[model samples]
Target: MQNDLFYQELDQFNLFSEFAEPQHYQPVPNDWFVVITDVVNSTQAIQDGRYRQVNALGVASIVAIMNSIKPLKVPYIFGGDGASVCVPSSVLQQVKQALQATVILAKQQFSLEIRAGVVPVSDIRQLGKDIRVAKFQPKDHFSQAMFDGNGLSAADSLIKQANSQYLIEPVESDSLDNNDLFEGFECRWNEIPSRSKEHIALLVQALPNEQFSSDQIYQIVLMAINGCYGDELAYHPITPKQMSLSSKVADLQNEAKIRSGFVGKLTKYKYIAKLKLLRHVGNYLMKNKVKTDATEWGGYKQRLVENTDFQKFDDMLRMVISGNEEQRVQLENKLKQLQQSGLLAYGIHSAPSALITCMVNDYNHDHVHFLDTTRGGYAMAAKQLKSQLATLKSVE
Candidate 1:
């Protein structure tokens, strides 16, 4: 009678058959692990106003070290105040070494301290399940006890006991319950803040795709900055001068590599040249010191002509090449005529936009402006007059 009743129930619903299927018992792969690393005292650091610089250095160090660990495909998620990484079981040791190196590098370069913990999982599905279960449990007792007193409430005491046990001996489990038998199993699944979930999701999505080279990854990070801060606070629209400068820097770097036996020597040279050029330009601006808008245009033009860095005055200058060929040729002719007639003065008593526009159209140039820290307006402008001279030459 009992067998007959079971059969009747099975007949009424196909759920039993579904459960009995072979696919339901398929084994889960046990070769995945997660590492969570948090930057220590990040709150104090941000309050100290060292957050941006320190965070950049820490992330750079971490990424560089992670890239060196071979055979291990790891996904690194940056969580603002910390980062998390996932790796395959086969390369667990390598991942550990990389994490250690990241900590060491961060300390050496940015004076930042980091703490990391690892957990192994049979598969991604198991990991998700375990995390969900862990999150449901309470996990912050020892910290509370330290601040309050030696004695803790029932929940706080339970958490502290779990933490102490976990610290003494690490264990991996699919499920841990808050019972008397498992008194020392504090759940830290909630250590990863909710705000960082999006970043974690992005890291997971980026995995299974081809890994990017260091330079490529750097570009990806810089591009992400625009989105990091909302559209309102993002950088202004990229100017033509900015694009041209970036391209020229890349070319110069590539050229240095080709010239030398090394593959990336040009990158170093380009950086050095950029530093030198900026210093010289800054000095010139300080020396000229245009106070009034009236004399600003003439003062800037005279400085550009006198400055050796603006070598390609006519053909391929920086600011003047944005316009068409006819406009550029006209500007060149006007500049030449002014120089010949000796009417090209060093400063303008009163500058007008029409004159500036006419000069730009004639020379086929776009002006590069820099923020004047002392003066509240855009007082410095560079007219890139030559196209081929896009690359800045090293002064020394």
Candidate 2:
């Protein structure tokens, strides 16, 4: 089994429906590890109107790990309030140290508690469930990881337990040397206004049934969403016209705010100043259609839209779509009918706008964007899904 190249070696598929198929997924190598990080009380934080901070912290975790394991490609998924990364054993220690630093950074900066954990693929297999992974490439320059089977869900359950052995606790520290940790992470763009009546964040998990396979059930759910909201181009949460860079000082200082204590105040101020200058330059370049060796500023917004993880699958179907109340209700009715027939459990949340957090290592390529709803995003939707799952368990 290849260690570092496990994910890089997988075959890539284009159709989202093919992601639901078992044949496309390969069992994760036993030597790999799945690192999970999530904010505690995230729903309350979102209710408190700190969804942007939560989203940033989640992206911070990913950036930290990716930067630590430099030159290594891994499979990962970005949940709204957290992220999950799978790395080979060779870089597990570096990943852990990065996560620990992130834990300390989140607490000191945002007053948010982040729980980090590590679960080995070998252990997931011991539970009789495997972490089967596949690569989904919607465009030539980008690809997203898709996970199937119940291994990731089982690993999540173990980590969220009261006394999870896999938990990575934070060390006591007023400041961690983390200025270099979250290198490419940024959240300077304004919240994307919904083009439709509202933007909806949806989570759906297909249940095991004797009549129809899980893949078939998910296909039904996808059809329901596309049928009601049209297709990806129609319902995608972000568009070129709706994208705007924030001119507010506070908005530009967003990263610097969380970056406090990690560096001296003077350094933080300089960083903020640099961000302001960069934003101005970016605006001018993009507006004037300037062409640089790294990126064509004019088409960057469209590329960013194309590269977003707006719709993804990681043991669950997660998406953010633009729709009206009527479309939402129609989709809900279809999901309800399917759930009543013992096909799936779903959760949905809606808000006026969608949130975006980005990681940009390069201008032309090597950049990926994350999306969520402003009000609650995936964490709240997952909470609803958990409630339905508990109820389903009670009746069974």
RMSD of each: 28.6, 1.6
Decoy 2 TM-score against native = 0.96
Give candidate 1 misplaced runs (Cα > 4 Å). Answer: 1-29, 70-72, 122-396
**Which 10 consecutive positions of candidate 1 have the poorest summed lDDT?**
141-150
Please provide TM-scores, in order, for all candidate models, with all chains considered together. 0.30, 0.96
Off by over 4 Å in 2: 172-177, 258-261
Candidate 1 C-alpha lDDT tens digits along 1-396: 132121112211122112112232212124455455556666566556544433333343334334444323233333334444444555566556555554554454356776555555332343233211000001121000000111111112222343432111222221212011111111111011111111110110010124543223323322333234223112221221221112234223322221221223454476447644654554455356635533353244333222111101110111111222333244345444432333221110111110010001011122211111111001112112111123212211
In candidate 1 the C-alpha lDDT for residue 371 amounts to 11
On the 0 to 100 scale, the lDDT of residue 231 in model 2 is 87
- Best by the TM-score measure: 2
Candidate 2: the clashing residue pairs are: none
Expressed as tens digits, the lDDT of each residue in 1-396 for candidate 2 is 355788998999998767788878988888899899988899899999888888888888998999998888888999999998888999988898889888988887678899999999899888998898999998999999999878887888889989999999776655445667678888889999999979999999999678998889998998998899998788989998999887667665658855554776787788788877888898999899899888999999999999899999998999999989999999999999998888899999999999898998887877999999998779888888889889989999
